[model samples]
Target chain A: MSLMDKMLALDQRIIFALMFIALAFPILSPVILPMNIQQYSRDSFEFADSIPSGSVVLIEGGLGAATYPQGGPGLEVQIVHLLSKDIKLVFFSIGTETAAWTVTAIDNALAKLPSGVAAENGVNWVHMGYVPGGESGVAAFANDIRSVKTEDHFGTPIGQIPLMSDINKASDFAALFWWGGSEGSIPFGIRQIVTPFGVPMTGMCTTNEVPNYTPYINSGQMIGIIGGVRGSAEYEYLMGMPGLALGQAMATNFGGLLWALLVVLGNVLYFVARREGGAK
Target chain B: MQIPMILTAVIGLLMIIEFFFPMPASVTSLNVTLRSFVTIISATALILGTIVLTIFHTKKVGTRGSEWYYSIVYVVAFVVTAGLGVLNVRDTTFLWIYNNMTSPIGAALYSLTAFYITSAAYRVLRARNWNAAVLLVCALVVLLMLIPIGAILFPPVVPLGEWIRSFPSGAGFRGMIIGTSLGIMGLGVRVFMGRQKEHLGIREERRDSE
Candidate 1:
């Protein structure tokens, strides 16, 4: 076979192997790719930074294991940043399956934070567990927060949590930060939680879903956004603290470049082989 | 008459009712219990899915398919992971396999989409139609905007990219959101009201026989 034909006929496993190598290389070596650093990331950090030390910030954990590597790192950084500012966090998951994951994410994040700056569970932060219903739950929370969640994730009553006691309604929160994969819940949060009460909201979402949330940001429904791992890296950079997000973003960019090259080469081979076959 | 379908319809009706009026304390408690039940059911579904995957591979291996080696790799990975998880081995061989082998492999697998996208874009841009040409141009613009070289070549491309992302494209996406929400609401209502009765998958078979 001609070179082009050989390339065109390459086994799928070979391609998978190449991809494996390309993705693993940057992650193992740890190279930080230079990014444009979108305003969304910067804005999210600024929103977190601008909140008063004792102000209540709601961190909505709406993701599951499927999105851990991509969305989780950004959340970890945001949680750390929020804690650094001495912000009081009210953690909750709207989707039922996400509650346990949310609590685990909080615990993982708190464990990573510096000893003194880390949020103290039940005091500095409280998880309100999973609330059933989507928009209805948000509306209920807006009207009477106590009605939606009586118990925290660990079965501690919200009444007992000092940080949650004063947050009787949506208006009490300085800002609401939602971290989730692509789901209707974020928009539900925007409409029922933020729009009606005029509470500012921000979102951290998968890269694929960032564009969907952009209009909410532009329309002033969402104050800011952090898109995927790259956005997380930008947040880490803005905070002057680098973590797993930075590594993941670098790996992603490197992977993107490698993939682009392979595509070009594959196409060139495809066209050349087609032409040769046609001639034969 | 399947237990699962009957339960689903009954539970769905209750959820819909809960939305319309202030439910009694017992009704609300039932709803919460139902939510937990759904969660457990979904978890079981995951196991069922894994079982299906194993059966598919077993068939392939038993039949001596062309990619039997790959099937073997997958089964080994699955068995090892499941074994570790079940045995509660924190730093077991399977955990290492997952952290070292699976995680990176999965990441790499997804990352390969970047290359496919580039090739797809090239082919798409080469199309002769005006709409296709416009799409191709928009894609190229977006692609260039994503990369650093585009900004270095044309500084305004970054803002231009942001504008494209935030304005025209954003409008389309918002339209999609509105459309999807309406669709989901319609589907939910239909399912709750028992208007759409394909839940059992037996209706088609009955129709075919008739």
Candidate 2:
């Protein structure tokens, strides 16, 4: 076989191995790459920032650990930013297994909070656990928070929970920031919260799901976005707190480059082989 | 079949009315009751699925056919996980198993997509025709837009990628959404009218003849 043919026919196992090394190297050594913040993320940050302090913001956790590496950091950073601003958070989850992820994120954010600031569970913040009815459950929760979930994740009554007293329905919240991992919760949020209640919404989704969300932002349905690990990194940059999201974003960029090179090389070889009649 | 169809039709109509008009207290209560019934049935269905899976795998293991060891593993994992889950669901052991065992397996399985996608993209992303070429170029641009260095090197690539995603991709997604919504509405209508009574264990032909 010609060199181009040989390259074209290169074993994909080798490609996998190379990709493993390329992805692992960043995790081990970690690179701090420059971030060109996207306007969507910036707009999301500014919108979140604009929420009047002391007003409650309902944060939806629609992700789990399977997407934690790529999707969790954005939630963590957003939690930190929201908590830091003294915005009382009422976290509810519609995705299965997201209740745990929500608690983990809240813990991470609380650990990093400034001295004297506390994410007092059931007081400053509360997790409503995994609501059962998916889109219907979300609509129900929007219509009557008490009926959908009478108690927080800890079994404390919504009436007893200090933060819950302020939030009776979706319209009572200053804003809604939903973090979507795999299940795209944006449409549900739009239909239930944004449309019926007129509450402004924002989202942070996994890397692959980011492209699908831009239309919502363009249409003014979504006020801002934290788009995957890259969006998470931009958020960290804006927040001035560099952490896991930054590292993962750098790894993602390197991984993207490696894939791009492989694609370009593969195409080049195909063209060369065709021209040489060693081809096609 | 008749009763289920009547029930479905009545509830569906009520839901539609509830959405459009402010529901009376009795209608609201009925709506809430119906929604709760759905949630309960959904949970029960999950339990049924678990029982079905256990039986299937347990039978596979008991028969001891070739490759039955995998079934044995599955049965054991399900039992232990389900047992732990049942015995104080918030127990540290259950959480540990979920975090250390289930979560990692799921995450690892998901991560495998990266390798498959990379290999597949290399094999299939070619300039075979104008359509293929356009897809290839758009893919490359979006991939570049995800990278920080690419954005820094060619700033315009950012907006170019955004434009492609916002217009072409968005239009496609909207089309899919509209199509899916119409299909769902059609299915709902069919089901409520008893034309889709297979799930109720009644054959359509038998019902139609009756």
List, residue by residue over A72-126, the lDDT tens digit for candidate 1: 7778777888888898898877665566567667877888788788578877888
Candidate 2: give its CA RMSD in angstroms.
2.8
In candidate 1, which residue pairs get closer than 3 Å at backbone N, Cα or C atoms, i.e. clash?
A: A259-B115
Candidate 1 docking band: incorrect
Give one digit per residue, the lDDT tens place, for model 2 in A1-280: 6666677777999989988988898889876767778888899999988887788999988777777776677778788788878888989888658878888888877888888876788878889887777787787778777666777887787788877776778999989998877778878898889988899999888878877776677789898788778888888889888888888888776678889888888888888777878656
Error of 1 at A242 (Å): 4.8
Docking class of 2: medium
Off by over 4 Å in 1: A1-37, A55-73, A90-115, A125-175, A181-200, A242-280, B1-13, B55-80, B87-97, B203-210
Against the true two-chain complex, what DockQ does each candidate achieve? 0.18, 0.57
Best candidate according to TM-score:
2
lDDT by residue (B38-84, candidate 1, tens digit) is 54455566679899999999889989998797999889878878888
Model 2 CA deviation exceeding 4 Å by range:
A277-280, B198-210
Clashing pairs in 2: none
